[model samples]
Target: MKHENAKYLRPQHLSGLELVRDICCGNLEGGSVGSTEVTLTPGKIKAGNHTADPQTAGSVGLLLQVSLPCALYADGPSELCLKGGTNADMAPQIDYTIKVFKPIVEKFGVHFNCDLRMRGYYPKGGGEVVAKVSPVSELSPVNMTERGTISKIYGRSFVAGVLPYKLAKDMATTATRVIRREIKDLYINIHTLQEKDMACGSGNGIIIIAESSTGCIFAGSALGKKGVYPDKVGFEAAEMLLRNIRHNGCVDEFLQDQLILFMALANGISRIRTGPVTLHTKTAIHVAEQLTQAKFTVTKADDENASNDTYIIECQGVGVTNPHF
Candidate 1:
């Protein structure tokens, strides 16, 4: 079957799963298994919904990461009902996409929403999410230079399917305690969710976010495992967020990498103060510089306590516009 806006479908092998990417002109589609389909339309990328289900449990969050940005330059608004794993090992979860990613992008005029219909976990792979995207004429530059005072910290701990509600509560409580120990007077609120039968597969996870006065956000997350105690999961996530904040970065390490391509595509100078640049960010910068005419520079922060751990990233955008739309 052919899709109107569809461009091509090529098979890919990863983690012992044979899959196909239903790539469109403007964006790359991470499709599920099955197909020799490839067609390229020489025009604007039209919006369309895709299903990546059946036997493969692909990462819906990964799909969104690639899809939403391209959709911003699409011919029109896009709606996607992506199916596969909502929570898996080594990929961003749906909650992170909503709580952390979506809010940060709004600062740059990118608007999108994800409505999760079902929670799909690993192996068994039955998850569904409805995502909506609105095209933008151009992306606005963002500057996050200083690590501002933290206003509040909010968190969510969820257990789905066969997992017990106690696990979710335990995770939330432990995470709250750990964060409180460090912040002292800081207020922390964490909600617990027990997804009984509403989700497709069995799994549990925790996500914690800290919001600063200057609109910067930092987060930590960890997924539940079979033998690992719930408290351990909570502690891991808490430590991750704490480490991120202690580095005195305007944004977390992961966000630094996530913003790389967006910075390159933006209209003007985009500056971000972040903790030590990760190898991921390094690779992303290299690829963006190679692909687009965007120029990027990295320099150490000038703070009295600044060491190799803190640095500033600046990007001069190529000013790519949505003329096709």
Candidate 2:
């Protein structure tokens, strides 16, 4: 007697199995992994040939929906191992790496029996992939100094992570332009957040060497979430220094305090007017007042507006044998 007609799997059933196998093997390219617009549709299968095991047959007709997480990396496609999934009220779990996808997997090969340390969780997604990246190259050394003459170097820094690249570049450019315009024969260097990691604020400093006839002044302005413009602040500071050098007048009171301290160290009597003092005639009157308590006798030039109204207060102190003519 011939055996009863054996059951044969149909084309449709074979196709369904192939589809599931393809997804499991990562054979299908869902979409651009980094694209925010891409989405994936789950596969479904219809009922077909049945076997004694209802479990395998029962799953044949059910639809399997696999939703993927959005890719966030901007660089190239990254290899990720899905840890596990959460089913509504189910607690989170991890997924073991069985096999890796091809091309990428072919190059990197498969990694089994590997431990994935979860540092943080991507909410809702059950599975997580950890990748080991290559180390970055070492940074080159940099040396900063004032060339020949004393230079006032000012630097303003912003958090690079917080600001866009273009905005940071623009801020640096604006600051340099303002500094060069205010100070003649001045050199300005502007660095970005990547260059300097100081907190977001502007700084102004001046440097003067005894050998150099002129002093160098610098002002740095920075862009912050909120505050005055750093470029303008730097400009104001440089301009203030320039005005002091040109007019021989006290543009900022801070300089007066510095002058007093500096001259005291040299044991040279220095006079800075507390009230409104011009570069014209009355500057001598101001210097005479400062010398009243001191032993040195103050003398003023008799000629009016002599040598651009520069009044030299001759301090006849013990160490100061010759007065500053």
- Tens digits of per-residue lDDT, candidate 2, 108-187, equal 11122323432112122222233322211111111111113334444433333233455445555655565567555655
Each prediction's Cα RMSD? 5.2, 32.8
lDDT of 1 at 217: 88
Please give the distance, in angstroms, between residue 181's alpha carbon in candidate 1 and its true position after superposition: 2.4
Winning candidate number (lDDT): 1
What residue pairs are clashing in model 1?
Answer: none
lDDT string, candidate 1, 130-195, tens digits: 888888899999898877788889988999887799999999999998998889888788889988
* Model 1: ten consecutive residues of lowest lDDT: 11-20
Give the TM-score of each candidate: 0.86, 0.29
Off by over 4 Å in 2: 1-171, 182-187, 194-231, 248-253, 265-325
Tell me the lDDT of model 2 at 245. 42
Q: Which residue window of length 10 is worst by lDDT in model 2?
A: 65-74
